[model samples]
Target: MLGGISIWQLLIVLGIIILVFGTKKLRNVGTDLGGAVKGFKKAVHEDEKDTDKPDADQPQSKVSHDEAGNTYDVQAEEKAKQKAENNDERK
Candidate 1:
């Protein structure tokens, strides 16, 4: 028994399906389903690849310059501030 249904019972259900929606229709439906699944998988993989890549148009630098021409790396400045705060706490 397959899934608690006998082989003959399964065959009868298959026959009914074939009779309702002939062989060609069923084949087309199967092909369309497979294509949809393949497209979904391809889209998912493309998204994953996109996320892994950094955008080419955007700047990668942490440094920024002000209108007066002063330049500084924001990340380094933040780290320095945190270190000072930690030192103050230790005291």
Candidate 2:
């Protein structure tokens, strides 16, 4: 019994999901999800490279954010704060 659910119960839920969405649809969904994850990882790797070779003219936003405005790195927050201060000073 895992998490108060039996093996049979888990199988039943899986069967229902399979029935509802069919095998082909599920395969497509899995493929799409894998592609999205691969793209995200590639972008992050590129972003890391860009951060290493800093550009003077373009302000680098080392920010990796989510839909709800949640930042991935603590350093991003500090950089944003510093940027805000710099902008405020210039005005």
Candidate 3:
């Protein structure tokens, strides 16, 4: 009845899985599944908490400058352009 799956269907699926991955492997699978479910629950709770608070540290603008005299945003753009040009040359 769990997730609309009948008992017989569940048994058949379990049997197939057991045949494919033996008992020891199935135990590992169960542990992995439990870990994944726990992680999912934690993630959902974290998302709810995040939604309740404002993320002040996150920047709204695309460009960020450092204390150095050198302009980093322009330098990054130039580097990306050079990389694209190099890729074009290779092709």
Which runs in model 2 stand beyond 4 Å of their true positions?
54-91
lDDT of 3 by residue, 1-91 (tens): 7999899999999899899999999899899999999999999999888787776557677775566776459888999999999999999
TM-score, structure 3 vs. true:
0.43
- Candidate topping lDDT: 1
Per-residue lDDT tens digits of candidate 2, residues 1-91? 6889999999999999999999999999999999999999999999888778747458667885457855489898899999999999999
Q: Score residue 15 of candidate 3 by CA lDDT.
A: 95
What's the TM for model 2? 0.55
Q: Which stretches of candidate 1 lie above 4 Å from their native place?
A: 56-91
Clashes of each: 0, 0, 0
Model 3 residue runs over 4 Å out of place are 1-13, 54-91
In order of appearance, the predictions have TM-scores of 0.55, 0.55, 0.43
lDDT of 1 by residue, 1-91 (tens): 6689998998999999999999999999999999999999999999888788778557787875457756678999999999999999999
lDDT of 3 at 14: 84
The alpha-carbon RMSD values of the candidates against the true structure, listed in the order shown, are 14.0, 19.0, 10.4
